[model samples]
Target: MSSINTNKKNTITWLLLLLFTVISVYIGEVLELFTTQKSLFIGAVLFIVFLKGQQIIDVFMELKYAPKLWRRLLLGYVILLPIIIGIIYLV
Candidate 1:
């Protein structure tokens, strides 16, 4: 059924995201590969985690079915909010 296939796809995406999360954490923490590097690497990894989390929220959390404006607002809150705050703090 269509719903069944959709569920499978969602599951796979989540698994992939989980795998990436583990890799990112391991590389950033256990190996300490990111500590000495620019914030770029850690930021990128965290950004990927955020993106995956957003996708999961959109799909499994049913945010995707919302109105376009609401979705954009939600994404802005999730993505841009931190950057704005960080910049403010830095300044």
Candidate 2:
């Protein structure tokens, strides 16, 4: 019974991730239609990347139950790298 519940939860999480991906793509397309600022578009895309990365790390990587330091390090890497890239692009 518990296994069935776990499977359902995982399925929901995966679907949510898929929805986020679709939303991200749609957002990118809309941004392109209305904006000519490369930096702004890149920043929005990077923010979506961060959201996806965090979801993958927490759910697929099974890092939600990991030690605090490990989770922090991995999530930090996922977040910081994109911010760095965006900054580099802006500059």
Candidate 3:
């Protein structure tokens, strides 16, 4: 029964990730529609990137059951890298 529950959870996680991926692609298409002021579009995409990364780390990596320190480090990297890149992009 535990195994079955785990499988169901994994399936749900996968489906949610797939939905997010589709949304990301749609956002990318919409971004192309903007001829000027791309910063907002870029920011939106970066946010989606962050969300996807967070989901991957938490669900696929099973970081939710990991040590607090390790989870923090991995999740921090997932968040910080994007912010750094965004800052670089804006400068």
Stretches off by above 4 angstroms in model 1 are: 30-35, 84-91
Indicate which candidate wins on lDDT: 2
Worst 10 residues of 2 by lDDT: 1-10
What are the TM-scores, per candidate, against the unseen true structure?
Answer: 0.69, 0.84, 0.87
Which numbered prediction scores highest in TM-score against the true structure? 3
* Superior candidate under lDDT, 1 versus 3: 3
Candidate 3: residue 73 lDDT (0-100): 97
Candidate 3 overall lDDT versus native: 0.84
Residue 72 lDDT in model 1?
79
lDDT score for candidate 1 against the true structure: 0.71
Q: Using TM-score as the measure, name the better of candidate 2 and candidate 3.
A: 3
For residues 26-82, what per-residue lDDT tens digits would candidate 3 score against the true structure?
877877686566677678878888888888888779888889999899889988998
Ranking by lDDT: 2, 3, 1
Q: What shift in Å separates residue 78 of candidate 1 from its native position after superposition?
A: 1.7
TM-score-wise, the better of 1 and 3 is: 3
Query: How many clashes would you count in candidate 1?
Result: 0
Residue 84's lDDT in candidate 2: 92
lDDT of 3 at 62: 86
